[model samples]
Target: MSSPETFDIVVAQLGDNWTLTPVVFENEDYQLPDTPAPFVSVEIYGDFFDQASIGAGERDDNLWREGGEIFLHVMTPNGTGSRQARQYAKQLVNLFRGQDIDGVRFLDASIGAGDPGRSFSNYYAMTATIGFERDE
Candidate 1:
């Protein structure tokens, strides 16, 4: 499967939290809604697959590992200084860091402070990046 598909699976694993309501796992080619506030978006920005070595002069065809980073954008209403967004981003980092989804392992995760300029002028936004890998 593609990286975006993997992101869907990750969001499914996160389920939902009431503290950050209206969470959205955007599908491929999806556009952000104009009215939603205090929402979360999970998106995969990159993916990579590499062959695994089993022994000398031997590579495992079935051991190709899929890995990538998923970007999480948390947005809140304007003038909040992204306070809520930062909180939600922290929660996301705590939930996914060093965790595993099925057999997919999350190697690392981190979140940033809110940046109003990075998103809509009416919203405060914070971002998180999660790196994951799995044998496929």
Candidate 2:
């Protein structure tokens, strides 16, 4: 027997409409820690919106079952960016069309704030749910 590959599952579950892009922002706001790390941005193209809407709409009381949206995942210390973030974001687009994640709130008060906190490493070994805003 063979072990299931999550990456392949991600591709199969998410389909072709979803894309993962790697970005390195030098600016203070977008900069990661000193480590040479990679963060992923998962985007659902325009065409997939229609498909996501139908499936998510018919589901039970699920946040992703109401409206369409684009989610952003950030890497942190504990829950750093894993393959799941990329794969799941795409799966969300493929499985939950027209679903809304307007109220998805992620708290990070422990990360500190202001300049001191800014100097701290943002790119830890964990992936975090950064945002889930509506596409509109």
Candidate 3:
């Protein structure tokens, strides 16, 4: 089974980049203020596996890929127009697309507005799903 630590590393790195908005992580406790505002929710999915081979014999040349995805939930106030959501989505794409971090290669992200699977029930949302892989 793949350990979530791989994705958590990405999460940790994002801490230094949260100046735009407050970031809420999955399974963490947070105290939302009385006023509703824009925020981002991060979710991670890690998939690490061992490939079975015939007669490779643990060769150093043998390569395996460990892949994962990070989901960015850009949540904004419902009363506001979609502009704020789109702006956040753009920044998220710019941050993750074609980037290499700690050996993880992040690919072009797929984005969608008003995602049906929003992390926050009360906010209008745009979701950015980034697929990343690392050579192991």
List the RMSD of every prediction in angstroms: 3.7, 14.3, 3.1
Q: Candidate 3, 111: how far from true, in Å?
A: 1.6
- In order of listing, the candidates' clash counts read 0, 14, 0
TM-score of 3: 0.80
Q: All candidates' lDDT scores? A: 0.69, 0.31, 0.74
Runs off by more than 4 Å, candidate 2: 23-38, 41-73, 76-120, 124-136
Q: Give the range of the ten consecutive residues with the poorest summed lDDT in model 1.
A: 53-62
Candidate 1 pairs with clashing backbones = none
Predicted candidate 3 versus true structure: per-residue lDDT over 1-136, tens digit per residue: 2346566667666776657898888787877667778888888776664543436666645676777778888888777777788788788778778988777788858778335534355677778888887776
TM value for model 1: 0.75
Which lDDT tens digits does candidate 1 get at residues 44-106?
A: 754677765455454544467787877778877777675677778878888778887677788
lDDT over C-alpha atoms for residue 127 of model 1 = 88
How well is each residue in 40-135 modelled by candidate 2, as lDDT tens digits? 433321122122333454454223311222233433333454454445434434443333223322122211112121112444322222222222
